[model samples]
Target: MSGQGTGRKARLAGSLLPPPGPARMLAVAALVTSLGFGGYTAGSVLFFTRGAGLSTGQVGVGLSLAGLLAVGGNILFGRLADRWGPREITMVVGGLQVVALLLSTVVDSFAMFLPVVCLLGVSEQAGKVCRNALIGGAVDGDDLVRTLAYLRSVLNGGIAVGAMLASIAVRYDTRSAYQILLFAIAGVSLFGYSLYLFVPRTRPAPRLRKKKDFPKAPPSISYVFTGLLCGIVNLGDTVLTVGLPLWVIGQTAAPKPMAAWLHAVNTLLIVLLQVRASRGAKTITGATRLLRLAGWTMAAACPVFWLAHDFPAVWASIALLIGVLLLTASELWNSAAIWGLSFSLAPAEARGAYLGKFSIGTTLREVFGPVLVIGLITGTGGSGWFLLAGLMAFASACAGPVVRKAQRESGVSDGTLARGRSGSG
Candidate 1:
């Protein structure tokens, strides 16, 4: 009987993997989109600082403002996706991004570039919302978690590759090289947009005839609270994206290739470990467990930056890699669990609004996270890591109860509680 039970569990695990079907095809489309976005992001700092001739301070401000615009774009498109549908928004946004990239090649002035970045931010928001919404709509049960994990891994990998290509382009110092990179980005984005052509249109779920289509109850305040916690946790990415690279370049002797190694480590871990992490998290209930794990992991990893001071370059690289592994694992769980919880908890008619609210949380993180990290590093010198660690711990503590409340409110159980209650009864 025990052997039979073990076999059933194994089969269930196997079934959770996304099968080669339309869902898998959509995942592929998502991969292509990631490649384009990743390539652009990897090259953005260099382009702004070198290609467009912006000072470091100006670059920081421009990037922060772009992040703010991204928040708006994410919320706007998320609401649009909920109101209209994912397919239309994906195509429109992806197409716009292609145009934005093409326009970027010609913009010679900072003023011209700023508006373009804002437009690109909108495109980024639309593409991300549509792709994520599609994945939510397409997959079911445990497969949904696995699918999202796989997608994130692919996205990170694409970013790594794009960054590498951008490095090569910048090395050439030829006008043609930059132009080629821009056109390549546009081409990949177009390919990604083309995938939307194949996606079937889904109608909004029917409203209850007995009541109004609007939410009958007051909005769940827990959602907003949860969003704030999420924003705090998301600040970790700002450290990863901007802080780490800058630290490596400024402190280390080998500035040129350091960013590549950092990006590679981040991407490699996600690609290899994300699906495994999702599998482990299958029995974990609610967003709290994941959020707590992320918070603690981030907090622990933050202080490890001090190790860079003592170690040889290779050893430091390894230590940083280990730190990133823990960070990415936290990311793998919190991201999937949060999205799943958000969708599950949202009123059927208000999924879009809820997603918009969620985007706002992320946007707040993006805007403030970078500025805070930059300030802490510049002001206090080496204490930025400790500050980040403390913030993460605080956020994690706040997230736990909210996630628990969400689980109870949604009437979902993670098996253990149900079994325990049945046994007790």
Candidate 2:
């Protein structure tokens, strides 16, 4: 690290949140990138249908398939980040994002739109892997979770601002409004990518470390299973983002606007409290505790949502608010826990690769979580919510044994276990 980098790190050490520099750069990039995406998202359906002349079904099917295709980028780039270093790959991906945006902007017909959207999807995934690896590498130990929380908090803020601004387009409901927003979004991607150049560069981490240096390291395979477990527990997220809103409208007496208000509360609470929530997550066992907490809280919240369906209108509103609170709690704690565990779960030899593979677990949730949520909850009845809750709680409970198994198999220290630190559970 240069003197400049050293100074930045020192400042960050004392600060409660991520200090300015690479972390700041990533935050700015997240904000602008999310801002642009939000603008388009506010009117994306109209852009595809009226502006691009595509049918509603075409946009739905096309984007869904595109998301599935996009999921492989993390695995594909995991090794690249390992071999070439995160900064190098991140710059390349940023450029690719520019190209993807250009292709999306140029699409005039549905045929062109399909491939362009798929390209955008892949680019989006690639950028997330590169940028996350870059941030993970740039920030030193323990600070990773808090730093990531800061970035996420900023991104949500941007999305909120952008969503508000996007209503102008929605209100006008014109092709010109859609085009202006779309083009502006492409511009935002270009600007954000350019800023990637200013972030400090780093070389690949050392491939070999002696046990004397740090004992109790696990092999790569153990984390794959761990990632799979983390990903499944992460379904709690999809439940909040997708399943809960639907449940509110379809099953409960709460009005449709209540769903939006719940989301607003969720976002606001994250921005306000994510850093404080990250404090207990420095150790692997601590991370497991947080994940377990997230699972049970989410599970517990479901019954509240179900209760809203049967309660009187006044009670229903109260139940729904309580449910949202629990869901938001799960989201905040799970995020910090995942960030710490993901980075800590893997040792130095291939941290980027491990994180990338770990991320696949979340991607798996994004792609298939809706199906599980809809099939179980929507297809059945309010009971489906309880079933989903039980599953999440079980998954949360697995964090401890999984880490212990990884340690036992790889000949690492079960120090946490020996110390009676196998999480609160």
Candidate 3:
């Protein structure tokens, strides 16, 4: 009976993982990629400042510049992926990333660091666009959103593990330790990039040129609008990461350590529930509904967080925990909706370009989200929470109509949007 119980547990665990194939392979690659980058992200500032002899201001400027450049670079790379084939572009981007990471180790001046970091950012952004295109072409529609959800979960898990591992380097607080960690991260990333070789090549999309080969077609503006709305909704993440910690430490009576615990809980919940949230989101209408739900849930959580400041230590902790739960729900739902809509809304042949264009909103948010969330929550105090709630609600309200309009304009039926996937779950 004990042996049987062990066997049953194994089966159940295996059932929770993606079926063995392209999805599984990609998940493994994503996991490895995240593991390396996670550590690098956690420790990059110290590495640049201490090991590379760059100042904090220089690193910040360099990263900001890299981010801005990557915004346009991602779109260009996505188009190239469509024209030149995703597999080939992805391989090229991967090679660039490995080279940039390795070169970063030898940099001793801001001038040298700036170009290497920019190269890294460009490669990273292009890699994301190409991977999305590859998955769109390789995976069946039934599993497209599910595969994305699974990969996200894997990435979160890997990052958490990598962060924990990097704590050793952080504790050492020496240049050599930082350099070693950077080198190890590069090696791991190269290994992860190699795994992409096993993934089947996605068919290249048609070139954007007209029949006469005069001018290329302009990208769709509708996707840009939808992407912006999705990016605004994603400010929920910024709130969780930035607003909550600040509020807990500055305003709430809850223990400051509660902030870290809340983040851990957020990660854990996402890793466990992201896949389940993605269900029923195959259709555009279904995805829109989920977006609305995310907005409503987040709206509710905002007030709860505001109220946490009024509570004593224990009650404040409880209230904050509940708020995190609600926010996590919002995050999960929003992510699922975005994945479904991004995949469903694109023209199949222009998948890479569309995906890259859709990502512009996210890129803008990364640039602006933290500042906006902090201003809203900390600047206005309690009123700011209600204002944020209203903003999210408004964005959510707009999402459904926007999606419907896009669907109509594109002349894509729910069946066509879902491809072989089931409608409305």
For this target, which candidate reaches the highest lDDT against the unseen true structure?
Answer: 3
Instruction: Show model 3 residue runs off by greater than 4 Å.
Output: 53-55, 205-219, 418-425
Q: Could you tell me every candidate's TM-score relative to the true structure?
A: 0.84, 0.86, 0.92
For residues 1-425, could you state the per-residue lDDT of candidate 2 as single tens digits?
59999998876543423576677777777888888766766677777787778898788777777677766677666657656777778767766766766666556787888887777776777777777777766666546777888887887778888888878877887777777777777788778777766777656533323323322222556666676766776776677678878888888787778878887888888877787787777777777788888778888888888899887777888998998889888878888777767766565445556667777777777777878887877888778987888888778778788766765654434222111111110
lDDT of 3 at 387: 92
lDDT of 1 by residue, 21-130 (tens): 65667767777777777778767667767776777787677667877888768767766665566667778888888988999887677788788877887787757766
Q: What is the C-alpha RMSD of each candidate to the true structure, in Å?
A: 6.8, 7.3, 3.5
lDDT score, candidate 1, position 333:
68
Task: Give the distance in Å from residue 103's predicted Cα in candidate 3 to where it truly belongs.
Answer: 2.5
Model 3 Cα lDDT, one tens digit per residue, 10-121 = 8755644677898889999999989988898788788899877889889878887887888898888888777767777888898899899889888899889999999988
Clash-forming residue pairs, model 3: none
Q: What TM-score should be assigned to candidate 1?
A: 0.84
Model 2 weakest lDDT span, ten residues long: 416-425
lDDT of 3 at 372: 84
Residue 347 in model 2: shift from native, Å?
A: 2.8
lDDT computed for candidate 3: 0.82
For each candidate in the order shown, give its overall lDDT on alpha carbons.
0.68, 0.72, 0.82
